[model samples]
Target: MSGEFHLSVVIPNRNRAHSLARAVLSVRDDDAGAEIIVVDDCSDEDLSAEYSQLQAMGVRVLQQDSRRRGGAARNRGVREAGGTHVSFLDSDDVWLPGRHDRIRRFYAAPGRDRTVLVSGALLHIDGDIRRPHQPDWRPGRSLVEYCYRDGGRVQTSMLSLPAGIARAHPFDEDLRVNQDTDLAMRMDRAGIAFHIDPEPGVTKEESPRPDRLTTGAETADLSFAWYRRESGDWSPAARSGYFLQDRVWRLADSGRRPAAFAALARSLVPPVSPRETARRALSMIAGEGLYSRLRAGWRQRAPAPADPGLIAAGERWRDLDARARAFCATARDAAAGQPGTIQ
Candidate 1:
């Protein structure tokens, strides 16, 4: 294995042990000498068997005695990572094939350095619905503006940066939600360069776990607070867009209609973009289900261009999904004293 740019894949897992193996398998590359670390956030269930399986596959597992959430777990992983570049993957999400090659290519390119943070598009899967999330950032646009005003997004699973930079700028541990956004904002403010790869690199499965942080009722409140904390350095238009579109939309989705309306009213103080705000308000009024279908339909009209890399990634994801289901079924059968052969 060449030592030009060793990659460390850090996966922060809580209680999602069933899917953790698949996540680990997605990024493991013995030939490339990629380091894989799984940081456990004080899971309630017994994970000894899972840890043993991961350890057998050469994954280094670390468990926290207390629950510190994903940010802290990720920080611990970064601190423990020994590679030149570090990439993160959630336990429920899996990186598609060619992600490591993409990272290595980015790092090997001329004019790239440790201060560069690389991200790629993600294939977000929610049940029968699948969509590709690609950021539309351009020159002279701040990360905040791209995210708020232009509908650009960057998830943790799609992020890869230098270990030194990640250690220097750790995630905000106290944040209950939107940690990815907060970290990106801080990195942008600190003059870290961002590079986005057009290829879809990860398959981010929307886990049905009810205790997931984003599904909690307090997500709106936490997101609103996060917006207020980070929007101070943003432009008025960015602020308005974030408040009216992001925060208010989240609030309405969480059934906080009164608070959402109040926030929408507040976003019109200087009237940055009345049309955008009105559109968001109308979307909220139309209900999430209808709006989601409409948005999906709109996206379907202009589908992403077909790429061989993306097509291979999707094929790999389906294979991994099948393997994960088979593994889970076998485990369950084993626990029930039945024949546990994986067919």
Candidate 2:
């Protein structure tokens, strides 16, 4: 709207057209004066109409022909952005209408600087909004230290970075799933401070998108690669840390029991939580195999029925389990009909 915008919202999208529209709309409503860029990663979906639609609404849609990953798309958007602060939105995620205004205030608060990366809580959904997982992230620590200490996640949608620092470190294009984590890790290793806005910002709809998860595995590989860049190698200790803790669950879901077991073993060293160790061991023993077990668990109804508050911010794991199952049914069906579907 003016000569210079305070924030540039970068959204990377694939085929999730409807969701993208809703996300862009939310941003526009909240941060009307901020610059918006929709980076299309060559999705087959007819987003031209959507692009035209957003452009009419004052959003800048950038087309990226080569589909590398979310990291690459985000990097391109940040590189092309013309704002002092950059925020990201995934194609399938939506932001609360007031998220931008709130975030801007958080960034402009006393003591805020370009060196601090801001992140907040993420609410997951599956046609129904799930409760926010109060991520115990502290503002004073470096991002890597946060990871080591709390094992928290920094979703791209809920994070805002200063343009100068964002330019210094771009998202890892090679990583599709965990690039955000990798970038935060890189930033942490480099002594950049991260500030967590104590509020939920992005809502993610989680379903069993196997390719997305496999893309996540590729991301894990790239994350390990990024770690190698920082720490010389994925230290057996570090590998067993948060990164492999996640991979063990994935491998378990993929039915790679032995590998998952090995990973679980690898993850059981110092700094590993006893609860997490037990959880991984039990997961391996249960023969849960990802979706099947998840669906089996999710099929059960919630003891406390969905209420307005529950829908907006419910933490009942049972409720989440049920919703995940419902969502996974469609995903499992989609994966079943399609061969070579990464699960």
Candidate 3:
């Protein structure tokens, strides 16, 4: 890669000093000529020791004036970065091996410009890295399909673009969740060409952290409204259909069949009847695992989610079916006692 397109890697850190080292090391581990910048988001405890070690290792560290959260930290990093091309690394996640080499070659292609945003795929690393996760569809010359129709997709580590775009369309500092998605939509609106790669770009580390907003955390009403507004340009039918589809997914993933069925009973957006919509929703959820009877029937964490159980098991042995039914019923009752709405 030429010096003209040097990469600046920005990692926003809070309380994850333990993981911050590995995140920084990942960038330094690669031979890519990228500057590493760490923006601290006012962590509660002092991480000065950790920060100092990184600084000695040639990683630059910047402190935020206040605890402005991930989005603000990232925006600040962009302001401080030295390279023309900027990329992000969440403090808790690490770059996969060979990422720098793969990406450098990709962007070094002739005619690749400041206007092109190249995004790659991710492999989930809980204990291993076999299970990969990518967006359902790739973005194209047009923004309509990516933003409005494809149900808003993008991740922080999967992206790399020009610093000018990052500065011009900074992450919405006010938004606690979906800030990346919000910024992606803004970049799309600003006419940045979106490019996607199928290769696993990063290895995401998923640990249950208390400081982090846990699952089901709701977005602020205004942020929610603005994000919805961004997609408001979609045709009414397309917008509503996506909305319904999203709700159905949440309910089914949580093993909330009653809510899922109730959501299905609502009117279809258009060109589809309620019954047909319900049938489709059921089929989709059933593929998640048609244990015992319903999604309501099984409340266990998906046995092997990466495979996604899209195909049915050949036969349902009577003994196995009975055991599944009893297990699911017990699990559902236990979950019912827990309070809080599924987002």
Candidate 4:
């Protein structure tokens, strides 16, 4: 909230009018003074009336004439942002309570100027399953290693960084998948500092829309291409781990067994994590469905989080969800007579 650390929240949306209001309202509730920008990526449906309602709420809605995807939309939002720092929220995601305060405290601390990015844990909701995605980053680990080797993740909604840095190091517009990983790897290679907050600050809903980019049939190939492109400078351990753990599964799931087997073979040229490689090889052999079921069973046997802090955060998320639904209902009513009422 201070002049030295005003936050700007940029949300990239495309035909998600039904969920856009919730994302906007989350930011409005979390940080009243923060700038909110929603960049529409040329949805097929006309959203002028919905945009108008959002505009009335003081949200800046930028409608693009052409579809450039979420990465480009985020880049444009950062370029247009007027705040000192920026955070991103996907149209389907919402921030948890105390997100604003956590960001403010992080930036206000001394020696934080060197920090180019900060991300916190996320409460990932996948249908009936809910899990916490904690940051796996440490001082000496590369982002790729943290992601592939350690099974870590940092979604766009969990990210916050200075506006200048975001402008200087823009997201890869060419990437339809792995954009978050691509940007984080670039930042890590640049030698800038990154901070990982342990607490969950975002509630990310994994939408099951078949039209979603991540669920596209080409997602496996695209992700593999991204790995090949970015892993050039990565250490052998990171490269091998990525192939064995991430690419192998994706390729297998996409019914690209030949490519998956080929990747598995390549991961062995300079063997790393032999156990993991063997496990993945078995998973690939077992087929995607069986592998998924086995993995789900293993997770079921694993203990659930009993942390008091996490429980409190879960309660807050439920409260936020209720409020977001109420806000959405109000928004829909306000736009009832309009051409597009965010149905």
Please identify model 1 stretches exceeding 4 Å from their true place.
Answer: 29-32, 132-135, 207-210, 261-283, 289-314, 328-343
Candidate 4: list runs displaced more than 4 Å.
Answer: 1-3, 128-136, 207-209, 261-326, 339-343
Residue-level lDDT of model 4, residues 190-263, one tens digit each, is 97677777766777776344566765448987887877777777778777767876677667656678888998
After best superposition, candidate 4 residue 109: deviation in angstroms? 2.1
Per-residue accuracy of model 2 over 74-174 as CA lDDT, tens digit each: 89999999998888887766666567777666666655555554555545544445554435665565565455435566767767877888889898676
Q: State the lDDT of candidate 3 residue by residue for 64-147, as single tens digits.
A: 878998999999899988987888888766665566666677678865664544455444322333344333554353444553
Quote the RMSD, in angstroms, for model 3. 12.2
Q: Over the stretch 31-85, how does candidate 1's per-residue lDDT look in tens digits?
A: 3368999998988766665566566567789888789999999999999999899
Better of 1 and 2 by lDDT: 1
Q: Enumerate clash totals for all models, in the order shown.
A: 0, 1, 0, 0
RMSD of each: 4.7, 7.9, 12.2, 3.7
> Model 2 reaches what TM-score against the true structure?
0.75
Give the whole-model CA lDDT for all candidates, comma-separated: 0.74, 0.64, 0.61, 0.76
Superior candidate under lDDT, 2 versus 3: 2
**Candidate 3 segments whose C-alpha is farther than 4 A from its true place:** 1-3, 125-144, 206-211, 214-217, 220-223, 236-343
Task: Find the candidate with the highest lDDT and give its number.
Answer: 4
lDDT of 3: 0.61
List TM-score per model, in order: 0.82, 0.75, 0.68, 0.82
Cα lDDT for residue 114, model 1?
A: 47
